[model samples]
Every structure is written in structure tokens, then in C-alpha cells.
Target: MIRKVVILSMLLLILILFMLTIEDININTSARDYLFENGFRETGSNNLVTAIYLDYRLYDSIYEAGILLVTVSGIIFMSKKDDDVL
Candidate 1:
């Protein structure tokens, strides 16, 4: 009985959060406009997409790459047979 209640409560909480996020979708437009107007000047890149990705979100990209490398390494390690080890 308690487990069902907890699951229902969690579902309701998630629903509320999703509704709140949907209401604020327009807020991102201002940032998009600012980037479109000043991205080149601030980042000194001719390509807008490149400027945004390489300058504004450089740390995010680097962390994502690191995460991918670690995930791939872990998968490779886990897939290896024990007999392969010396």
C-alpha cells in the first residue's frame, strides 16, 4: 500500500515539474536573440553554431567528451574475458 502511494506521489511531482518547464519555453528566445546578435563579436568565430558550441559551451562539450571516453573504456573493460588477462 505504501509503495503504491510513493510511486503515485513521485509521478504527480514529476508531472508538476514537467508542466512548469513547458510554461517557460519562451524564456529561451531572449538568449537565442542575444547570441545571434553578438555571438560572432564575443567569440570571434565566423560560424554562429561553431561560436556557440566551441565558446559558449566549451566546458560542456569537453565534459561530454570525457564522459564518453570513460563510458567506452568501462564498456570495453567489462566486455573483456577473464581468460584474456595475464
Candidate 2:
């Protein structure tokens, strides 16, 4: 009984999320125009997405780099063997 209730609750939550995601709303139409008007030309990048990813949110990029570094380190650590195995 509890399992059925949990499954039904999960299904209902997923259905609500799907419905919410399907509703499209226009929130910011002038965001691009604003960025262009302000002087992205000085940044020396033609693509707005690249400019934003590399410069506007560099801290997030740093965090992403840290994640990659940690992932690589974990992979290397897990792949290593003891002296007897080596």
C-alpha cells in the first residue's frame, strides 16, 4: 500500500513538472538588445553566448573547471593499484 502511494505521488509530481515546463512565457525580450547597446564590442567576441559564458559569468566557469579537475583526480585515484598489484 505504501509503495503504491509513493509511486502515485511521484507520478503526480512528474506530471505537474511536465505541465509547468510546457507553459512558455516571454520574460525578457530586450535583454539581448541591452547587451548589444551597452558595448559587447569592446569584449572582442562576436558571439553573445560565448561572451557571457567566458566573461560575464567567469566565476561559474571557474566552478565548472574545479568540478572537471576533481572528476579527473577521482578517476586517476580510482584507477591506481597497490604496489602488490602493480
TM-score of every prediction relative to native: 0.58, 0.59
**Candidate 2: residue 6 Cα off by (Å):** 20
Q: List where candidate 1 sits over 4 angstroms from the true fold.
A: 1-28
TM-score, model 2 to reference: 0.59
lDDT of 1 by residue, 11-84 (tens): 99999999999998876588889988999889999898889779989998899899999998888889899977
For candidate 2, the 10 contiguous residues with the lowest summed lDDT are 77-86
Taking the tens digit of each residue's C-alpha lDDT, what string does model 2 give over 16-37? 9988886865567586787686
Steric overlap count per candidate: 0, 0
lDDT of 2: 0.80
Q: In candidate 2, how many Å is residue 19 off?
A: 9.0
Provide the overall lDDT of each model, using Cα atoms, as 2-decimal numbers.
0.89, 0.80
